[model samples]
Target: MSALAIILVGLLLCLAGALSVRLAVLAAGFGVAWTLAVAFDADTGTTLLISLGGAVLAFVLTLLTARLLFFVGGLCVGAVIGAKLFVLVQGGGADLLLLLVMVPAVALTSGLLARRFERPFLVWATAFGGAALVLSGVGRLWADAAGELWRPGTTAGVVVVIVVWVVLAAVGYSVQRRRRD
Candidate 1:
């Protein structure tokens, strides 16, 4: 398959995986709804309508599968990664590797953390997002240390990510502590 086909398939599976997580339903919903905006394979109106329909279905499915959300999330993440693997084998692109590795890894780790620390999925999600931001910033720094290390955008992103994660972690700890009350 072509690279565009591969990316499209990957994105679809990612939408499915994201929809599997109740907490991520909003993002997934919007993402699916924006399909037309990104893909030009069909009439804009028709594509947008289909996207909206899919978003509604995904949102309902996510809510109904809330109890099994993590397992579903893992499955979806795995599927997306698998799709990426297929793309890579087809000589898709270097970015496929990042998606394959990051998606499943983040899903597994986040699922585990959320399970171990229930009632704080929001904080955990925030921390995970922050960690990702920090990692991305670090990668940029590695790529061009001289240009971005002290750049306002880079510094701000890194600092916000770290501070957010730290604050979330502290909040998680506090919530756990107070639960004994």
Candidate 2:
């Protein structure tokens, strides 16, 4: 059921991206990378490490072209979504909430910070992964607080994901506005 939903999302994303050349390229790149990762059985830590490496590559390549933004953004979003899928398959509700919330939040914050502070790749990598670890702990706390957790939607993870996505989407819009300012 959940697998079907995720597949539907991937299809929709591909369809939407196909409407534009730029989006199509992004979607294709993401699909290829995701497929490779899955085929390789890349675990959560490995995926993060690979993404961090890619982020560094993008940062370095940014010296030549400003197009690194696309790579960084793509890598961050892909990693988050991929990690969430892994959690959903391997872990329970607690793991799902931890990855889903922490991954996007960390990725977004780091990407934004990288631009604002001109930070090193190592800094972004460490901060992002460290934040995820902290959030995982917090998820465990919430799991403990909750009397029982069977399905994710009924648990704290669902609430956190909903709230976080709403807040992040708003923040993303505001950031876009400020960038236009």
Candidate 3:
């Protein structure tokens, strides 16, 4: 049920994120709330209820301070990219210190760019984020049904996931680009 909900939300973000920034912001809040709630070992119902409350608070705050939130989102996206680059470059000896130093620099740059190019950046951000959610939700559903992990189990699973993410993001980006005013 949760997996299904995730897929639906992911699709909404992917296909219509740029058309509705408010919804996208709400979804981001909800997604973050859900992730944080799940990290605690609590009753599922109670956790979900609390998560929903948190999401609501986040949505309201984001609505009040949209520009600040977009800058934060840019920082997050840049930090992720920077960390990934660090890992890939360092490989077996990925240094935490270097990553810590690198992430902030990249994040700062990205935040500035996001502020300058809000709509286009949001379109890209939503596309990438949504694609990730769709893939993760599908993988979770598949694992639950089959009692196995698909991405890690397959020999080329990682590559396939990356390829799929890129394709899905591209499709979403293209569609949203056309649709956005």
Q: What is the TM-score of each candidate against the true structure?
A: 0.34, 0.30, 0.55
lDDT of each candidate versus the true structure: 0.46, 0.44, 0.70
Q: How well does model 2 score by local distance difference test?
A: 0.44
Identify the candidate with maximal TM-score: 3
Q: lDDT tens string, model 2, 1-181?
A: 4434543443333223212223344455555555566679999777656655554554455445534553464446446444543453444435656667666765666556545543233233322332332233334445655322212444466566445434433443343334335
- Candidate 3 ranges beyond 4 A from true positions: 23-66, 75-112, 144-150, 153-155
TM-score of 2: 0.30
| lDDT computed for candidate 1 | 0.46
- Model 2 ranges with Cα > 4 A deviation: 1-63, 85-137, 140-143, 146-160
lDDT of 1 by residue, 18-49 (tens): 22244356567767667755676767777777
Candidate 3 lDDT, 1-181, residue by residue in tens: 9978987977877777656667666677777877888888758897788778877987788768878867876776566545433433443555788887887887787777777787688788667667766776787787866312223444355556567778998998988988864
Best by lDDT: 3
| Residue pairs with backbone atoms closer than 3 Å in model 1 (clashes) | none
Give per-residue lDDT, candidate 3, residue 152: 42
